[model samples]
Target: MTDHAQEQEMEIEALEAILMDDFKEIDPSESGVSTTNRCFQITLSPQEDDLDASNYTPVQLALIFSHTEKYPDEPPLLNVKSIRGIKTDDLNMLQEKLEGEAYESLGMSMIYTLATSAKEWLHEKYGQNVLDEVVEEPASTKDDIIIPHGEPVTTETFLAWRERFEAELALERAKLMPESALTAPKDKRLTGRQWFESGRAAAKGPTTVPEDSEEEEEIDFDDDFEDDDDEMLEHYLAQKSEKSAEESKN
Candidate 1:
């Protein structure tokens, strides 16, 4: 057989494997078509587990199609028919949709795709019959509909979230600084180089900066110098003491 026929056979086998009793091979002549083409029928409906038999208007459809000589390269002919309670209008609409899909799916196996689309459509349209049931359904029916959950946190996501959260948190904390958390007055010492760089040593006398004064700030790889801050403080104090001793000696 040609690739087209071989592909059709494989698709038929896959459908049978999946649908079991719900799929069947039909004689092309039965649908008033020539025997040269192959035909198939698949029954479709909302999942039985989702239906409320008591209040449900049962619906089932038969999606019938035949592979053409150039099928997959060209679209196949299809017919949708009511097998149970499905209406003529519904069948027509579904067939229209399948035809559109078949056009889009040219050069690929698509009967199974169409069948799946039909089943989902059927469920959307007819599956809601369960809502009409007078009795409350068991939780199992509710469980049938998966509640989509959040995506798992990946390393990339975690890092992105942490960056955003820390920025927001810092902004909020900056807006409120408790007085109890303020450094004690005695503990207000600058890094020694920072004091000299600030030009505070040029001041001749006591300059009391108002605690309430708004000081506009003008905004370093001195890493090794961090360990020498205490030594720098002692050096400055010793020079002041020596100057005082020389004055005393004079």
Candidate 2:
């Protein structure tokens, strides 16, 4: 109905598109504040690249806000909550920082901007090795220690590791190939290891039918029958030749 309302509507749509599952419209009562306007919350986490650097405790937080009746003219009411592995003091500090930014960002759609700031802060504060200090130690490492790598290989995982090793060696040799050969390769090549990933691999050895297979038995039976028929024909021809010779002699 008003310019402020129109701006809020557009910003909400943009945030929903960008944040996907992380952004959601929450009940007004969830804000714990008496308000006639819409309230919403955004889940925030540290950026992904930094999280991959080392073992770290997962951290998350929520940025909850409500538009005032005259949003954009007045700053939105903001709050921060520790969703995971965040301390109370951290939430207070973030709340004050976001509220200050809200005032500074008055007369504009500030929720998305505030969410971005919160995410960046989360990354800087908790990303990489910084989270090691806050990560919880296992109750017992001797028994309860989780595997750091992936699922362990089973007996059924008869991988052709030798082929993969040879392939890798070949790849290394290929790297040392002539400059002209490298420039225009004959075919697209993928390593055996690459092919063997994710349970989708070719059989390691040549495919073989079982020794007790009925197909092989059936083939052997047909061959034996053909051999017997040939022997009978040879015997019959021999007898006919002998009889013709005796008749000619008489």
| Best-performing candidate as measured by lDDT | 1
Weakest lDDT window of 10 consecutive positions for candidate 1: 173-182
Candidate 1 residue pairs that clash: none
Per-residue C-alpha lDDT of model 2 across residues 32-104, encoded as one tens digit per residue: 6578578888988775644542244368788988888799889887878887778888788888888899899
Model 1: lDDT of residue 119: 87
Clashes of 2: 0
lDDT of each: 0.71, 0.70
**Can you give the TM-score per candidate against the true fold?**
0.48, 0.48
lDDT of 1 by residue, 1-250 (tens): 3488888788888889998887898887765445457788888877565554334446777888888878888988788888777777887798899899999999899989998999888888776773453367556653253437977556688899999997876554433332333343647644335443343334335556778889842223255345444444455566678889999999
Clashes of each: 0, 0
lDDT measured at residue 72 in model 2 versus the true structure, 0 to 100: 88
Candidate 2, run of 10 with poorest lDDT: 195-204
